[model samples]
Target: MRRYLLCTVLFFTMISCVVNRTVVAKPILFDAEREQLTLEYMRDRYGLETSSSAIDPKMIVLHWTVIPTMEESYKAFYEAKLPNWRPDLENVSGLNVSSQFLIDQDGTIYQLLPETTMARHVIGLNHCAIGVENVGGGEGLPLTRKQLKSNVWLVKYLKEKYDIDYVIGHYEYTNFEGHELWLEKDSAYRTVKTDPGEHFMKKVRKATRKLEFKLVPEK
Candidate 1:
């Protein structure tokens, strides 16, 4: 009787671990300066009105920072306004664009902003998606295997924590047209974007599958 009871307890514990559930880690908070800047920039650039109510993130969007270092990426996103070079950013910021997370080439993941907050990484979907930006993917510094591995781990971690329904690359976001999560300002607001390309997304999705997470279709 004692042995049967012990086995039953262990079995239920294992079952509980396998169930799909939302588990959130305490979000790493941004400094007051960056936090204020991001909030203002989102309002000015996208005309988005954010609130504590915007915490139900349903997707994870991946990006590559053609820039060299994480610090440079941080500075770009740290400003209160969008920069001029990216005329596309005229509405987003005068300093630099921002994402919720920044992953370095070495696979170091930095939480630039809170997970529950909105990031300006994607046009219409930023309100409901979490963005993860990688350090380098430009002319010389191609994305590395380490970066890929890190992304896979990060995606799995997020899936286990959120009621996430989809994992997508920044390039594929446009295909989700008319979906409930799609939110853009106007037809002209749509612009072509290809970052952290197809091969990378494939690897991440493959890794995520091993953990029993579902991939959103490439529409």
Candidate 2:
């Protein structure tokens, strides 16, 4: 009887650890419109022949939204349609880009969309990647330690929840090309980025090294 009691107590303790973490889920722009946007992004940009928005995430891609304030960052991704400002991306995807989660400068984490659903933040790997966008990484506005800690916690939480195989920075996404996960049809289509930069990624990797996520595969 004592052994059974101890096991029950241990189970609740584990649940507490996960439940105690603060993840503010403020869903924005999720509906039939947003769902269609996801579908369009997959079909047009990736040449994926899927008509539905379902996704089985296998990787987590990190990014830094250069849009400084949390409100502006939220607004940028809250739209279901892409704005006309990105003429360079017109030929690629007509749908607005978005991420599943956004981490504020103060370390607050907001769920912009369902974690497993596709977010159009990374190139080539969107089909299998869940994107997490950090709020700021512009000139003189470096990422914060609080954000780092939150990312570590979030990654661990997600690993426990999903069959996550890799955690990569946006810049490292190209490395996944030619690997089994690479799904983009147009080999020439690619975007260059330095977001959630080298130093920031180094810290996240050090914090999450024990998680055993796959390193980006070589071509």
Q: Estimate each model's TM-score.
A: 0.74, 0.87
Candidate 2, which segments miss by more than 4 Å at Cα?
1-19
**Can you write out model 1's per-residue Cα lDDT over 25-118, one digit (the tens) per residue?**
2233345654566566556544656633244788999999889997777777765456556786575444346777888887667777777776
| CA error at residue 155 for candidate 1, angstroms | 0.8
The list of candidate 1 runs beyond 4 A from truth reads 1-53, 92-96, 211-219
- The TM-score of predicted model 2 comes to 0.87
RMSD of 2: 5.1
